[model samples]
Target: MALRKIVVLIYPGMHPFEFGVTCEAFGMDRSDDGLPVYDFVVASETEQPVPTLNGFTITTGHRFDEALDADLVIVSAGARGGTPAAVPATLAAAHANGAAVMGLCSGAFPLGEAGLLDGRRCTTHWRDAAALAARFPAAEVDPNALYVLDGRVYTSAGTAAGLDLCLHIMRAEHGAEAANVVARRMVMPAHRAGGQAQYIEAPLPPAGSDGLSELMDELLAELPAGHTVNSMAARVNMSPRTFARRFAEATGTTPHAWLLRQRVLLARRQLEAGHEPIELIARRSGFGTAALLRHHFQRHTGVAPTAYRRSFSAAGPPV
Candidate 1:
């Protein structure tokens, strides 16, 4: 078999990290692994020195034709609005020619702009999720997923999620061994199951809400055994209505939404322990129903509950 060629499409006001990720992954030689190496090229509509977020200039070495027949063609996100503004003809053609096309972060916006993500499961940076969904009604935008791969089209979430996307591709292309190798070299976890929920930041408790931090931590611990926002709010001596606002202000997300994600996290632990059935998992995690658990499980997590338990149980933890 021929060595695969990887091409990245660079645009004006290009994001340094997104494009640099591809360079670090595919452009730089990892020949020490004795794996079939890829030919890496940076292509653009105009082969010129393109400006980037980091203030340094990165010149493209190839034009659109060089991206023809590329095994992988990635259009990286930009720092500015052009991210979803238009899709260059080169990108459109590369996708048409059977190349595996990917959009990283806001890069999915451009892919959506190109009409490529229509009917496909795709995700972008959480900040851009609303815009991505608004811009392309046909795309199933997953705000909480780290990345989405529907068939040959791969779309990733925010900046660092590109690493997960590329590593996932490596696993798909060459298996776990190769992906692990690259991940080890990068000092990052080889795999992170589920989508963006696992990576969401918990909003800190408000300053005046003394004891709320302890309360929230306790809430996390008790969620596995079932705790509702109303119950917790009552325990804190506040009405559910007032508590909801404070919870959102303090934690940066609504109470129910926050609880669901926390439940998923706890369930992941139980799954890894291999001791809990999905029903027990549902009950323990406050989901109330295995069906509801499965819904959020599949949504927040890319894999199903059983599959997650099986894969991660053996692996010993959720990465």
Candidate 2:
């Protein structure tokens, strides 16, 4: 269904940034750029002022009933407790009435409380994934996805991921052009490459000079060159085994894996920039052949190169 009306649920102790994501995505007037301006409302259970997490309050006149006719209803991260009964009741009603419902970060808790997540796939901040699963045993929770959409329910990971989910919805319902326009207005990437896994905290590798940095720069400069670990190790004056160990210690990934990821990123940029043939793009990205590029590209991005180009190319649409 077309998403023209949007209602953002605000509550006491909710994170302001998450709520702002919804507002920024749909509230502003963008008709000057030929984008649809959503009928946006900030709603609560009552007409009272709602306190935010950072010692401030927001006054909203709309009530949860406003969500009943909304095309999209958003729930941002709320307080650290079970959802209020009224919140869930409203969400349940909105969902029953065919509104596309979304919960950002800990907001997924409310959707779970409303039983909207039951037997459906969802996600929240990785830190809260285990707790969300423990609380809602019937929901399949993915800790690594930036966002998950099952049926009419949508859930996202931590703060910035809310924007990703918003842009995704825009892209799906409006078109890539609209999403790209929104992303440009927000000064963010229209589509990110990886999921929340890349954001999870891990022990940083010890800071030191491993020749790997220079080698990587050289490789990036000449990606089409046939460079193997043995060749790389020889250039760095080390045995292949030693090079592999140091590479892992320095980058937290195998050399081959890192190279493949870089190649895929390069391929994505090439695909986004111009109408280069798949064979030419494959050669430039060091995949050697179109079939190999397609294999690895799909494995990493879950989409074919041509499809990605169509969605993100600067030209209006791929021909």
Candidate 3:
């Protein structure tokens, strides 16, 4: 059998985790596993040393010309919007040549810029999810998804999510047994459905005053249906203006953002358990309507409530 070539794109300010994931998954030698061998190489847009966020550097031995010839090409994520990726000519060539392509983390930005994400379902980190949605309204963006496979193009939610997608890819290319062998060697999970949603919620700060703390916890548990900001502020015996400022600084995010994440988390547990219909889930999770639950659920997990339940395929209803 012919050896499958795997080429990974290493850009400046590249994430070590993302690149390491590719190397660990596809770049290792596994001839003894009776699997088709992979010829893996790290190539760069330029021949110079690639800088990383931790101030370390990795030198690339090959360039775009060699990378474009690979059967699989990976674009890795890095600092949020810091490293401006050059849509290297080799990437277009790789796509043109019919190679399976993938974008991980902020790596999706470059792919989007190269028109790779056009007319395809994709995902990125939740922090940049809103921006991606706003930027590419026509393109379906799932910020909360661990990864998304749209035809030949595969995109993962954030840096860690890359591992999930790679293992998923291995399962597809080989099978459960093969994927398990590779995963066991790496001390990672062998199977996480590509459609499994991402759980990225910003934690709220502990309440300063006793009265406010109790109220805050309840509000989080019962989100949209809970007390308003003013009501919360009154519970702590403070003005709404003062309370909002304190809350923002304490939580490191606006109340609205924090609340949305908490609510989404609650809804995910319920959806996975297959406890109720969309309307009940929406009401209990504080979204108030099925459409509202779906909007946030889709934003966070990359799939609708019904789809999420169906993906489980366990004996009983969702759990």
Candidate 4:
């Protein structure tokens, strides 16, 4: 579906930064890129100024009525210990009317209250996932995912994951080209796969563990070379089994997964730099073949290499 209208529901104590992610994703003027501009409006329970989670206040100048015909209705970040009395019905109606309904962070509570999350795979910020599940016994809550889309209902982890969800929506509604334009304008990765576990900052290893850190630095520096779990374990002078356990504890991901992510990052940088052939770029990024590069690249970025190059290569001066 082409999303032309969006209505964001706001409340007292809502986080402004989270609200801004939707604004940044849909409200921006990107006509020069030949992208569709949405009729984005912010709505509230009342027209009165609503105080934010921070000290300041904001005025939406819109009412719940604005959501009736919206293509998308988003519930922004807010305290979700309880659902706002009037919101659940409005959100339920929007979803039933074929509008895509989304919840950012704790906002999932309202969607849950609306009975929209029932039997659907959904998520909230990891911190609130348990509460959401407990409150709505039938909902399938995925605590580890960065975002979950079940039918037209979407939910995401805290703050930045809202942007990831929005980009995903854009890609689904428009195409890779439009989403890439907005991502480039925002200076963010057009897509991020895996899950939110990678974003949660784990406690650091002991101070004496600097050797592992140094080894990781070297691995990143030499990402163009093929890396295997066995080779990496040898580099750290440890048995493969021990290395795998330690790697998981430290990075929240396995060695192969991390290597693929790094290679994709390198490939993206190369694609943005100039009009290099996909085969050469693939080999330089350590994928060794254009087909392998295409598989992983599209898996992560949602666009094929040549299409990504065409979308970005001539858009600006060489980096």
Candidate 5:
């Protein structure tokens, strides 16, 4: 069934940004653009004015029961506290009745409280990922994913990730073209490469490592050239063991992993810009063959090179 009805559950102390994401994605009337206009409702446990975290309040006439027949039920993030008793029961009933339920950021807590997250892969804001896992031991939590979908249940990371999840749902249910239209209207990218791993805060290199930093710049400039640990270590005037250890300390990942990520990033850029064949793109990005590019590209970005090109290439997919 198509997703045409959406209910966003707002509550006291809920963050406004995530709630706004749902409203933007589903509540807007874009019928002139040949898009389906959703029956969107902002509901609460009761038909009351819900206070926000930012000293503002939102009044709504709908109540939690509005979610029971919704095609999608989105639980927006709220202040850190115990899940409201009504939230879990409403979500569980909606899910059991075939509605797709999503938890944005800390909203996953209510889903977890309802046992809906049991045995499902889920995630929330990275700061709260460990707590979500520790509290719901049966839930498989991935702190690095921007979003995860298990059956009819969906969960996303921090604030902006909600947009990504909304776009993904659009693409999955409607098509890439519909998603692109919505993205263009919103002035956001239709798809984003990589996971939340790129956004995590990590310690930077110590101030006195110009040599290693310079080597990294050189490696990026010559990505197509074959590189080895021994070769890179020699360039830095350090043993391979020392280079590997220091690289991990400075970059939070091994040298090989960093190089591979750079190559994949380069491939993504090339794919987005032109109509080059996958084989040529693979060679230019240091992958040597289209098959290898497909392997690593999918592993890194969760989509095949050609599919990515189809969705993002300015000149459209190649013949």
Candidate 6:
């Protein structure tokens, strides 16, 4: 179905950045860029003014009634430290009607209140993941994911991850070409998978780990070529078994996993920059064949290679 109506539910103590993510994705007029225009509205329980987390106030003229028939209903973060304030029942009804429901950051709390998250895989900010799960035992909360989607309900981690989920929805609904236009206008990455880790904070390695860093850099630079644990260990002048253990300690991920991610990242960069044949990109990105590239690319990004390129390429839309 064509998505045309979007309603963002706002509450007291709403964070401006969280609210703006929805507005930037759907409220802006992008018809000039050949994108679809949505009937976007910021909704509240009452039409009264709502205080923001930024020490300011915002007023929306719409109420819960306005969201009853919306194609998508988005819950914005509330004030009380990721614990939502009173949520309207209309949100539950909208979900029952099969409208796409999304929760941005702490917004997932309201969905839980509405009982929309029961038996669903959802996620919130890392800090609140445990709380959300504790509050709603039926919900499966994944703290590491950037976002989560079970059926039509969507939830994201803190802050900018909301933008990622929004763009993914746009891409899925409107196709890659249309989503790419909006992403380009906003100057954001066109796609980020829901399965990606929420936070990748690794402090500087200890003094002796410098060698591993240099070795990893070399491996990254030589991604288009064949690599194995033994080969990498030989390059680093260490036993393969010892290299594997040290590599995991330094990178916090296995070598093959790291290589796969790097290759996919490189392939996506090339895909987004220009019109390149998928096979050529596959070869350059070290996937060896278009089929292999497609397998890993889809596993990582939740979209096929050609579709991904079509979503972000500067040339005309994907065929």
For candidate 2, give the lDDT of residue 299. 77
lDDT of 3 at 145: 73
Itemize residue pairs with steric clashes in candidate 1: 144-196, 145-195, 145-196, 146-195, 146-196, 203-251, 224-284
The candidate 6 region of ten consecutive residues with least summed lDDT is 198-207
Regions of candidate 2 where Cα sits further than 4 Å from its true position: 193-198, 204-319
lDDT of every predicted structure (CA atoms)? 0.77, 0.86, 0.75, 0.83, 0.85, 0.83
| Candidate 2: worst-modelled 10 consecutive residues by lDDT | 196-205
Q: Across residues 170-226, which tens digit of lDDT does each residue of candidate 3 receive?
A: 788788898889877877556666666675545554756445567667786567576
Per-residue lDDT over 244-284 for candidate 2, one digit per residue giving the tens place of the 0 to 100 score: 99998788888788788888888988998999899999999
Give the per-residue lDDT digits (tens) of candidate 6, residues 1-319: 4698899888778778989999999999988888888999888778678888788888878887777788899988774344434463777888887788888998888888889999999999988989999989999999978898898899999987999898888888889888788887888777767886663443343346838878866777898999998898898889988888988888787778888988888898889887778899999999999999999987776678787676567765645
Displacement of residue 227 (Cα, Å) in model 5 is 1.3
Poorest 10 consecutive residues by lDDT, candidate 3: 310-319
TM per model?
0.72, 0.67, 0.67, 0.66, 0.77, 0.69
lDDT value for candidate 4?
Answer: 0.83
Q: Tens digit of lDDT per residue, candidate 1, span 125-220?
A: 888888888888998988988888987788888767898888888887888999889988887777875363534644555565645677877887
lDDT per residue for candidate 4 within 1-319, as digits (tens), equals 6588999988888888888998899888899899987899989888789888897988878998888899899988788765567788899998888899999988889899999999999888888988889999999998878888898899898887889889989898889988888988988778754243323433333344525777777877898897888998998899989988888777788878878877887888898788788899989999999999999988766668776666556445445
Colliding residue pairs in candidate 6: none
In the predicted model 5, the residue pairs found to clash are none
Q: lDDT value for candidate 5?
A: 0.85
List candidate 5 stretches off by more than 4 Å: 1-5, 29-39, 46-48, 68-71, 80-83, 96-98, 125-128, 144-146, 158-211, 312-319
Error of 4 at 275 (Å): 20
| Candidate 1 weakest ten by summed lDDT | 79-88
Candidate 5's residue-wise lDDT over 163-232, tens digit each? 9899999989989999889999997778763253324433433455737788887888898889999999
Question: Which lDDT value does model 1 have at 7?
Answer: 85
Model 3 residue runs over 4 Å out of place are: 1-3, 79-88, 202-213, 216-319
